[model samples]
Target: MPSPSRVLKLIALLLDYPSPDVRAESLALHALIRTAELPEARRDGLAALLDALCQGDLLDVQERYDSLFERGRALSLLLFEHVHGESRDRGQAMVDLLERYSAAGLAIDANELPDYLPLYLEFLALGDAEAARQGLVEVAHILALLAQRLAQRESLYAQAFEALLALAGVAPELAGQCYQAQQEAVDDSLEALDRAWEETPVSFTDPAAGCPSASPRRQPAGVEQPLQWVAQPVPQTHPRATR
Candidate 1:
């Protein structure tokens, strides 16, 4: 067994190492911190450990993790060869902490996070549709806030829309009902806009009232002409329309 004083000294050294080098030292720190008998000692060591994790440089930032790992392991008995299993005490919690830490880091740049759809699709395969839907919605919300262009926003929206469609499949009638409700909402919005226009003074109406036939079309204040909306007749119903 390593001496308690030596372990405390090593912990201090580990805390001072650069962030990219932390992973290589994690197992050793965990072993030392767990073996320590004093609660204060353990607390201090774990706090340093968590800080190292949360503030670490990007996992693939330098694309030199393996090299850094070998170098750091050379200085301490980090036991890189040991196999951790689910039965190991605190193993699951440690794994969760690591994953959450990684996700939190990725989330810092709202737009740059990796494509999460593939992992989510895997989750859906396991029959966790609800969880998958929730994840997609969360991602969509993030993308909506970050997307600067219509193209990117549309891409992210499509993912959420597909998940929503999958959800709607579980309730077919509700899907149709929701579509009808959405259309009704749009119609109501247009009606309200028309009513508001009607309430405006006479001077506001002529500019809005001009038809395509109104020649040397009067340019209404703040309205651009050649007016963009030109009404065309709808063709009479025929077999060609069905085709």
Candidate 2:
């Protein structure tokens, strides 16, 4: 079983605006998901997303992508929007994130910002497993929010976000609504279930598996850098639940 990092990489592509190149790789992407060491449900949901991408007219698919993500701040692909909104702090946060990615050996194309979720995921995909999970956990609440909003809109894109939450090892069903993901409880049953699966974190794989949408920006691995700076600007996030 390949590491789940490939799933992260693929999910990044799934989340991005569809391109002809992306459409062309549909078959390979499906094969990759089919063989990933994921739970049946995760694999199925991902496959359904791929199906949505593949089975529809190209124009229709592109329109749907624009409708869900491009039209509003609610589902912005940039991670900071949910956290910083239009604040000045978002500017500094962007600089900090770019430096961290630079330290990781990934370059920022003039066309892309450092905080875009797919680009961020690509950086996580290139590194070791623990780092990737930490990257996801750092933004776990945002992922949940995106998942919840997408699911509410009945968008297949929700599957990609939900799959990311699973990889982050966040508790189930806390989609969006500004829920604090780390605060969610993982009871005995959930822990045992996790143990039963015992999956490893996503790590770098063969270079051939790279997704084309964002790969043009990747350089070689640089000195590994810690993202300690990617702090969660903790807000009034989650309500405490009583046991």
Candidate 3:
């Protein structure tokens, strides 16, 4: 199988919280969209998102992201929330996911959870191509769900999920089954959010934590954590994805 595209890591970086680092690489990202293996339509959508990011002050971009993903559970970036909600099953699911990352030679950092979409994508980018494709297929329903939600709000972030679905090559017949089955009412209103996130997010990979890994061996200290996998751009250089 062909290896997964480095574009996966690029998308992960862009989907992450808005940072000046993104702005700094705007040119490279644009070049990537122009030359990536994605279909033209998908590339166009992603370009729109990148354009939106580079349009105005970084602060405005950051605020929009906060309003979209932070204030609501509907568009929350945590993948498991869409599947497991707040149920206890989510915790075990997270442990399983962490094991997958550890088995893949990753050691998590930044107290990030196992289910954060960006972190998940970075993990997939480093995996076997078939495995990465399967991983994207596994979550294609959630991608569809989020894409619909974001598009409904006229949010540009929908482009990112749409791009993911394209890469996943999800059969149209099965694409929306789980998404269409979501019948619960989400309460991510202003007041609900005010009471939410009262505590810090937990990170299972924190070496300080005693949570032991079942992997054959532990990742030795001082390694590339998450989000650092994106091959960066160099000035006046031809930009290419490393994978």
Candidate 4:
């Protein structure tokens, strides 16, 4: 079996936004996939996605990503979004997850939420392989739903989710149940999709509600806080009446 870290790295690469240098990135990604030592089916699925990404126009890829992930809540990349939406529960969940990342010395960028798929994958990539696999399995239902939705749209990105399911060792019957539950819950119409994104804002005011104060706070790695200096007036010695 391929190490969990290696599998996660490939998933993270796929989840990232296709930059202007995507062609070159795709080339490199393909090389990694070739030696990933994944099962034949999983490897081929990943390779197919790479081929599609490399062959497509960068603009189309960017637009598709935005439409699928950013504009629509049904396909949002943030894991908690699927579970909690704009509810207070989601805020609390985010705070708890942020603390977990902090404990692991994983520094998330200010603009990136800890629940984002790519960030989550990066965190997994840095952890114990067995633990990562267990974590992935815990979220297997989410992955399965994502795969089903993407496959419904005939998007190549569906392959990434499929690869994740394979890595997590999710049984086909379980995956089917997850997909069926998601489909039943989601309306999937254009209006319904739009409404899903129009969620009310969530605020975390109570310290007890979010990250508990009891949890120790550690500065994220690679971030430096500027030193605070208290302003003090310098004593001016009266020029000995040098008149």
Candidate 5:
């Protein structure tokens, strides 16, 4: 069976398509099969919904894109929820997705990202501390992304502040570094956003270079960076846990 992360990636891709017909049809098909629902009823309902939505003027393209993106995100999170507790190895795979994708440009939901908090803390306490640290890094990067995107929006700034606070609660030292980086980036983004607003908000026709949203590439084979950063010390809590 395909992993939950793979399935979610597929959902994210379908949602990112620029064409309405492509987006709506793919989503409807996914919902029908994923839910194991009655095909006829599902098809009829989806058809009506798509027809009504398609009748809108092409000028509303941005609205359609946002709606489809949000829907796909909701479905991906649902898939992650279903697989999170099924098996530790498999659950870790989804957690791996959370770690890698929550980067500076990827728009991850702040609320949804916290779902990994318990798993992250538990893993640090029980599994691999280095691995857990990696997860925290991803969360920090996501916060930075949010702060940059919401630099001038008061609501976004508030939400990003809360997210930073939550991250600090997890691993204070690491989160503090992330919060500082995000604050600096936010300041820069606001300056850019302000200039753009006076003229036209900047838009990009291509994905950011080296962005994780294009799919994470394989890491170079070697000792992990964090392992190099900190020496492995004798466990203070569970001296016996470290073999």
Candidate 6:
């Protein structure tokens, strides 16, 4: 197994958008990985990815990253997108995850969601090593599916997910199942991509139409009750933190 620190650093670097700085960082990470005593296959896989990132044209890397991650939802970096897409449950999950981060004293930017893969890795980096491994295991299926999809696209980024699976101890049979399930979930055709972007009518105006009923109904004049308020704790901010 790779060192915990190295694994965390590699994941963070892999998730970043390719740039001159990232290219430099990839080179540094590559050197570190070369010296580490990891399994030959695992080390080679990660090294190959780092090599591609370091050698590829920056514009090409940016375009490929956008096409694979930005345009395609199947290979999204947001962990919850695969688990709970645009559902009320996903919103609740985010709220709960944010609370967990707060409890752990991890501050995230207002614009970044809690389920973002990099942010999640940052959180793990701050915790116990065993706990971090367990956290990765919790989402092993997602990583496995993403790796398979990226490999099909011949993306070097797929190695990052493969490394994650190794660290998370995902079984080959289980990974296969996860990959098959995700494949069955979406149509990867050009027609499907076009259809996904087609505009639909807004339907939020009608209160009685399909929307959930509003909570805390107003009381009649005679039944009015005194209002109660509960103060919410503000999230701590860290401007200097890389994550």
Count of residue pairs whose backbone atoms collide, per candidate: 0, 3, 0, 0, 0, 0
Pairs with backbone N, CA or C atoms under 3 Å apart (clashes), candidate 2: 5-202, 144-176, 145-176
Models 1 onward score TM values of: 0.20, 0.72, 0.73, 0.73, 0.26, 0.72
Superior by TM-score: candidate 1 or candidate 2 = 2
What is the lDDT for 129 in model 5? 30
| Best-to-worst ranking by TM-score | 4, 3, 6, 2, 5, 1
TM-score of 3: 0.73
Candidate 2: tens digits of C-alpha lDDT, residues 106-183: 776554566677888888887887767777766666677677767767778888887887887775454333342222
lDDT of each: 0.29, 0.63, 0.64, 0.61, 0.31, 0.59
Best by lDDT: 3
lDDT of 4 by residue, 37-85 (tens): 5678788889998787677678888777766676555676766655444
The residue-by-residue lDDT of candidate 6 on 140-186, one tens digit each, is: 65677677877777778877787776765665346545234333334
- Give stretches of model 4 more than 4 Å off: 178-192, 198-243
- Tens digit of lDDT per residue, candidate 1, span 12-119? 243222354456666766566555543453345354544445453656423332222222111111111111111233334333423443433322222211122222
Query: Model 1 — which ten-residue stretch has the worst lDDT?
Result: 234-243
List model 5 lDDT by residue over 1-243, tens digit each: 332222223322322323555445655544533443223443343344334344556447545433322222211112222212222344445444455333212334433332332222322333233433343343443334333334333322223223332322333233333223222222224455444223221111124422331112223122132211101111112101111
TM-score of candidate 2 to 2 decimals: 0.72
Q: Which 10-residue window in model 5 sums to the lowest lDDT?
A: 227-236
In model 2, the Cα lDDT at residue 235 comes to: 23
lDDT of candidate 3 over 112-217, digit per residue (tens): 5667788788878886566566667656666777787777777789889888877777643356543443343445566767544432322323466553322223
Q: Residue 45: error of model 5 in Å? A: 19
Which portions of model 6 show Cα errors greater than 4 Å? 178-190, 194-243
